[model samples]
Target: MRVDRKIKASYEHAIDNLDKKEENEQLSEDEFLERANLRSDLQDLLKMEEINWKQKSRVKELQEGQSNTKYFHRVANMRNWHNSLSCLAIDGQVVRDGNVIREHISKFYAELYKENVLLRPKLNGLLQYDSLDHSQRDLIEWDFDEEEVIKALRALDGDKSPGPDGFPMLVYKCFWHIFKVDAMAVI
Candidate 1:
């Protein structure tokens, strides 16, 4: 996008310079042809840029509308309503009280996650495999350098899901210099 903007600016500047030259002096056949060609090229570039801008604007509009539409909210509310537990059966009896339901859920999960196993089977000598040597272990444990971090970031697909902060790889890749220190520290 920046490159396109720069190209557009240069083309506009060239056209303006050509116009100024035409106004100042009488042009030869070749100069007139050059001016005409430049104008045509500038027009073509501007048309393409306008189409690109319109496409981007339409996409943004669609995304914004989808996110904020009444239908979207209704569907989300419907899903929440469906997922909510209004009643539960416990000990062959229906439970509707909120406190009872909460207690039942908490007790059920607590019992489910309770450590009941007193003795677990050991796998110490059952399986034998070669392990990594010192150098390999060191390589795996070493902190990432700037090059490695940049390479990993670059390797990620920019169009994939964004991180928890809602920024995509494209953002980091585009503004690496600004984010390098913070990103490295976090990593």
Candidate 2:
């Protein structure tokens, strides 16, 4: 209902000045064009947010399930997958201790990636496609809008693992209104 009201208001504003230019003309033609674009963009964003909310609700319902037993087993399986270690066999022995397993994995990967300083055949055109198309890439590199940043923060799963900073999505979402200006500036 709120979204419908907003859509209606925006539609009226856009249509009111559709063909006739404003007599006061405080805003330039470009500004008027931007206002017209805002109406459509707002409608599109509201629709997308509605759809995302519904999808999230459906996913939560499915995860909870009608039966508690099935939900518990499914969650346990996910936890196992997340915490599973790559069991490695080294020197005809099995190592399972946390530190030893980590060291073994590190050593294996280190040696696996070690470069050989030997003469090798030359390859031509290996760098093809290495450079991005500047024009095409520029399209995606625009600064984030405040609403876009907020939407991204809201979309992050609060239960998911935090990044290197150790701050979870819940923290960001909680303080979004306070930090939104600074966050948008950084973008």
Q: How many backbone clashes can be found in candidate 2?
A: 0
| lDDT of each residue in 17-135, candidate 2, tens digit only | 75355645566788678767876776676666556545555576677673455544554455466468856667988777878889888988999988876766566866566666998
Model 2 global lDDT (CA atoms, 0 to 1): 0.69
TM-score of each: 0.35, 0.31
After superposition, candidate 1 runs with Cα above 4 Å error: 1-124, 129-133
Local distance difference test, candidate 1 = 0.80
Query: CA lDDT of each candidate?
Result: 0.80, 0.69
Candidate 1 residue 47 C-alpha distance from true site, Å: 54
Candidate 1 lDDT, 1-187, residue by residue in tens = 3237777788788878878888889878887888788889977876665566556555665788656655455544654664699999999999999899999999999999998776767798999989999999999999999999989888989978899999988999999999998988988
